[model samples]
Target: MGYTIDPTIIRDRFARSTNEQLIDIAENEIRSLTPEALEFLLDELRKRNIETSQIAELEKKVTRQHNKNVSRAHSALAQDLSKEGMKLAVKMKLENASNSDIQEALQNTGISSEESLRIIGSLGEKAAAMNKTGNKNLRYGVIMLLLGCLRFFIIQSKDDLNETIILLLVLSGILFSIIGLKIKSDAKKISEILEQESLEAQ
Candidate 1:
């Protein structure tokens, strides 16, 4: 059952509504309004000395707008849920979760089974690519750090040590390490968010 508004409240609202506002509702929103609301609105118009014949014609033009409005509302809601499901799915996938686990987690959020599967399917390749990139960055960062350290040590043992080179090497190593670790840290944060959302959903 839909929500029911008090008749008194409805009457008060209509009583206070301007002619423009009232006519706007009758012309554009009459079809979507509750029956009781329409009844109150018509009564208000009658008290305003509006002709019954004009009201009758306005009622006839109720058209298909209400169905269109309902369709758009449902579409918008589905899109929002789909976006939420995709975010959860990506986080779980990054954490190396199974498809079934992601699907279940999505269902727990009120997403339908078909939508959950579609989300999983769409994200599969993208998630794998992200993992690959993150791992690559991490590996490269470690190599850069180690190479810089080795070079620093070798230069230290030499009589003609280049301070400029050593400084550049150390700075580059720190930069790369920070970048790589930042990516990994971001992934870890996403996983933590997924857990939190999952618990909240439950």
Candidate 2:
């Protein structure tokens, strides 16, 4: 009845993250003795100005990335196990199952719904605690992408008399910008969380 830290678990955390979050994790958790690292980490997070919701998005992304990595590693391990004549049950029961699987198992086993809710709620609260700053970059990035698309469309339409194509391009750009901002916003939030944790630890 003992526990172990799976390197794959750590790798899964990385795989589920944006480059920024991965960097933050490295700065905060994996690295030590980097001069004034905690203070610098917090300052960097402050400069980024991420928000709680965005941070939640980051956590989701990291979780997702972590899951993907887990899946890949699990699959690889399964193949190795197969070569060694290990049973499927053994493979499936590994610690690297997806978070969804973990949650589903907890729910299916009649773990109280309230308890599950509390766990989920706590995760959100953790993210909020990590990043107090709201995400300005997310707002600005979206606006800029939209404007870029609009400008590109107007220029093209006037040059080629293709109003329909111009409109479509503008719409596409706006949509892409909105989506990109949302993704980046999540990454920003994740970075903030890592930074906050790093600062506190120091």
Candidate 3:
């Protein structure tokens, strides 16, 4: 089936991604393009960087695999679905079930575990995004608070020789920095997982 390509959407994706990411996307798209277009595309890439050798190797490998393909049909493709089960799956999805929960609920519904997880993962992504955004805010807030407190303490220390107060300020800053870094690290992990999953699905 043919779908419309939105230029704005394409530009936005390019805007949000790096050149290396765009290169990977082009590699996948090359498999579906005509030989003439593929050659032209590779020539353009070569002009950008001397990396067409790797591109040529990848294209040859995937093309050979495509030509020699001999895999069995998927089981899910063979089974028919019941209306009620389909409705239940839809409802479960709409209710924001987790990946594990969806897979369990969709058990014996002619869906493969991989496919079930993929569907649920797409829905789960929204929750992850919200969580990532909140975590990002928390990290930012922590950093700002630490900076503000440090500034305050530095100003206060200039006019006083209170060892206890300086020690407390230093300890508090260390503790807050550690917590903020941990939160930032966790948020980074979530973002990377989502990005990796998205690339794999593509």
Candidate 4:
């Protein structure tokens, strides 16, 4: 069976390809894509290599391409790949981004690779997963969750427990829930901002 080429995969490989490999692609499979599709393909490479000062122009061209004649899937794939280059500078160098974080995050933020970027891309607090901030959140969340459970248990175990202690435990549980919700919200926003930056390498 024939397999569809994943445009981003082609762009990713081509971005890293040697001149000889590019020639091979040109002589073979590259012929299948439309000229506009070809432009979109090359744009992905340019996105990563273009200088900062020139990014805005390229971005305008990219956005325009979105509404062009290429296959919608191809257009989307090209856009996603080009987008990755947008966030490369800030995302890769983030204090918590991995050693592999730089490469993986690039691949990820670039959306060159699939799926896992959600966790590390956002909560990679000050780095990749389990970084100082993420770890702290993980530890703290776990402790708070546990403490909340303990407080509930204490109330259950003692019907006569002081009203003050009961009130304090009630406040602790609510506080834990609020903080947990905030962390979850923050992680999602971070991931989204990072992803958006990739769209223009901002």
Task: Put down candidate 4 lDDT per residue, 1-202, tens digits, no spaces.
Answer: 1114676665566677764444444344444555444564456545454455454554444445444535576768867765554345344444334435555655654454533344334433422322334445555656655665677676565555555565665566566556656555555555555565567665
Q: Among these predicted structures, which one has the highest TM-score?
A: 1
TM-score per candidate, in order?
0.46, 0.27, 0.28, 0.27
Ranking by lDDT: 1, 3, 4, 2
Q: Candidate 3: deviation at residue 108, Å? A: 17
Model 1 agreement with the true structure over 1-202: per-residue lDDT tens digits:
2215787887898899887777788786675666566667767776775667875665454334445546777899999999899889877876767779999999999999999999987774544455566777777767767776777777575434565666666777777667766666656665555566568779
Clashing pairs in 3: none
Each prediction's Cα lDDT score? Answer: 0.71, 0.46, 0.52, 0.51
Question: What are the RMSD figures for all models against the true structure?
Answer: 12.4, 23.4, 16.6, 18.5
**TM-score of predicted structure 4:** 0.27
Worst 10 residues of 3 by lDDT: 69-78
For candidate 1, what is the TM-score? Answer: 0.46
For model 3, how does the per-residue alpha-carbon lDDT over 1-202 read when each residue is reduced to its tens digit?
Answer: 1112454554454456554754664665544543333343444444454366775665565455334332212323433433344445445644544446667776667666765655555543544554565566556556655665766666666545555555565566566556656545544554565566668779
What's the residue-level lDDT of 113 in candidate 4?
50
Point out where model 3 deviates above 4 Å: 1-161
* True-vs-predicted CA distance for residue 100, candidate 2, Å: 15
Q: Candidate 2, residues 14-41: lDDT per residue as tens digits?
A: 3455657745653445223122332333
Worst 10 residues of 4 by lDDT: 123-132
Candidate that scores best on lDDT: 1
